[model samples]
Target: MRLIACIIAVCFANLLYAQTAKEIVQKADEKMRGKTMQAEMIIKTIRLTWSREMQCKTWMKGNNLAMIFIVAPAKDKGIAFLKRKKEVWNWMPALERTIKLPPSMMSQSWMGTDFTNDDLVKESSVVEDYNHTIAGDTIIQNRECYIIQMIPKPEAAVVWSKVIVCIDKKDFLELHSRFYDEDGKLINTMNSYDIKMMHDRIIPTRFEMIPADKKGQKTEMIYKNIQYNKPIDDGFFSTEKIKTLN
Candidate 1:
């Protein structure tokens, strides 16, 4: 009877662990939904070996839509990018024009940053677009992580064929991701670093993207003074604001 009781307890413990991991991921996703952020970032291009610092703002509604507005360095001021559904558009200050980004260019580098254009914008939820499986448990930067593999669902429109993510075991915050192309070739790796206190929660302050083929080609995004869940007008995301914002 004692042996049977021990076995039952072990099974219960395993179930609890699985539930905890799922809750962690759900919390992280919930915190990011319907939020706006303002930041100053330094972008470095490994290919050109050049870097630039700029101020920016972003608004996101759920995982499907977001917009980033650039506000600094004079030359880049008033420029913005909008992502809605599967479409992306860029607003240029000099030309006072909006240009729609072609699907083929989604993988191109974003403004000389190490991040691809797709990386700048968030995509559909990993749970919605892919089938997630817990790969294992590991440690990343001293924090226990649940290593999860996400493969695109059969009907999902995803650029990468597969993605591996490490989520913090305690907070469910995403720590790292490895992206693979359709040919099963590893294309890029992204790391989240420098956790900071934002809105009473510890959040990653810097996100770095590095290409697998280009040595020393990397982009690092540093977010400062982030405030979440701020009140923002829908008009802020409209084309009118894109035209007049500076």
Candidate 2:
């Protein structure tokens, strides 16, 4: 009788642990939904050996939909990138032209930086686009984390074949991610650090992207003036705003 009781307890514990992981992911996803973030990004490219700083704002709604608007120094002001479904469009303020991004260009380096264009504007849904598996528990920067492995689904339209994320157990925030290519080659790694308070919520203030092949090329983004769940007009996301934002 005692053996049977012990077996039941172990099974129940396993079930509860699985439920916790799912809940963590769901909460993290909810925090990112229908939100906008403003930040200053410093892009470092191995080819150029010089870093360029640009100020930008990103808006995301639902899943797999996001738009980024650039507002910065004289050169790159008023540029915007719209990512919806599997398509992407670039609006250039200087030329006053809207250009569709080709599918092949998704894998190209972004702005000569280590990150690919797809990495810069990630639009894949975590639930539908990838298969998630728990990789057990680990500690990252003193925070208890659940290491999850995410592999692109067979029908997913994503550039990376696999991604591994370290999710904080307490807050469900993604602390780090490692991206791999279709050929199973390591591509780049992304880390979210420097936690700060914004809009009454604690969030990562610094995001870093580093390439596997390029030793010196990395891009760091520092978020500031972040407002969450605030009213945002639809017109702010329209192509007209891209042209006038400069």
Candidate 3:
């Protein structure tokens, strides 16, 4: 009789603590990205054959505008990309040309990295494009998390068929995420680590992504500097600016 009573008590507690998957996702997104943000990071692409580290600065405003410019790797410097609404443009300083990226190039890898151009440009908003369901709970890095399975809504413009996200329960940090293909096969997995206070928010300072089928390939992004909700001119996210400014 005591065992039965204890089981019921535990179930009741879990029910009270559980959150809707959509709510959990929104909270996690809000924690990471606020209105306008500017950040500098280094991306290390580790391959069995070769490894390289690239540095860049990025600026983003909501879901509409984003711009990134490479600052390091002397040979690849002055390369920039700008995205606004559904449009994307790439500036090549070596060629002195600004080419508009077509929709067909969305799936191409960015800078020869595991992340695709669409992933780098972020043409879609995660919160708006997907229908989220509370799958269950799991533990990541010794922290309890809310596991959410997200599927694209009808006619939503998204590439991934499904994405599973694990968000830390206490601070709403996204600890890990898995991307699946249209056939429901896992394609890539990304993990967050080294949680620390940056600016005003506590977030993971390091992110690593690996392809499921590739054993010797991975990409790691380390946040060197970040400032959220900083004043940024809308005019700055333009092809003209990308062509001229570094």
Candidate 4:
């Protein structure tokens, strides 16, 4: 009877840890993303030889809807991407056509940058599609953080095999994340910094995604302007709307 009691206690403790981890992640995610958000941002792809930069405007309505419009660089301008629930589409201004992105294309790079198509489309949600566990705690950028491990659920069509995120304990800010490939190889590391108040909410204004194998190559995204919970119509996320976005 004593052995059985010990086993039950251990299982209960594990359950508690899992729940706490999920809650921490949920809060952190919500803090960063309000009900609706729009931002103008710049993405710079840096390499040892040369670098390229592009500006874009982005909108998000809940977890299921998102849109991005490339606003700079004469050649790439007016390209747009829309995500409505599980479906993703790309609008090419040059081709004058709309392409529906399949699950196979989710792993590809976005706009010749370190960020994957999945990163922007967000077809798989971290909170809903992965199992979260409390791995440990650490400090990042002088902030105490709770390290959470995420493994994709069997039914989820996610690109990463494993993801570890560090959330600041006080503000619930996501300070850093490490993404691993299927063979348990580290693929990328994302760091968030320049935390400040963006209108009504506080968030990390700058993000950098560095590929593990690429030396002196990384993509930096900096938010130029942001507004949270602004009224956005659901129709704005449609493929028809994306093609016509100016």
Whole-model lDDT, candidate 1?
0.75
Instruction: Rank the models by TM-score, top first.
Output: 4, 3, 1, 2
lDDT of 3 at 170: 98
List TM-scores for all candidates, in order: 0.83, 0.83, 0.90, 0.98
- Best of the candidates, TM-score: 4
Error of 1 at 22 (Å): 6.5
Among the numbered candidates, top lDDT falls to 4
Candidate 4 worst ten-residue window by lDDT:
118-127
Of candidate 1, the 10-residue stretch with the lowest lDDT total is: 31-40
How do all the candidates rank in terms of lDDT, highest first?
4, 3, 1, 2
Judge candidate 1 at residue 142 and give its lDDT.
Answer: 96
- Backbone clashes in model 4, listed as residue pairs: none
lDDT measured at residue 121 in model 3 versus the true structure, 0 to 100: 85
For candidate 4, write residues 1-246 as lDDT tens digits: 999999999999999999999999999888877899899999999999999999999999889999999999989989999999888999998999999999888889999999999987688788999999999999998999999999999999999999999999999999999999999999999999899999897899999999999999999999999999999999889988987887
lDDT of 1 by residue, 1-246 (tens): 999999999999876765654555666666544355544555545455566666777677656567888877788888898877777889998997899888778777788776778777754456567766677989999999988777888987667898888988776678999999999999999999998677656888788888888886777777766666677665666666677765
State model 2's lDDT: 0.73
lDDT, model 1, position 89: 85
Please identify model 2 stretches exceeding 4 Å from their true place.
Answer: 1-23, 33-48
lDDT of 3: 0.88
Query: How much does candidate 2 score in TM-score?
Result: 0.83
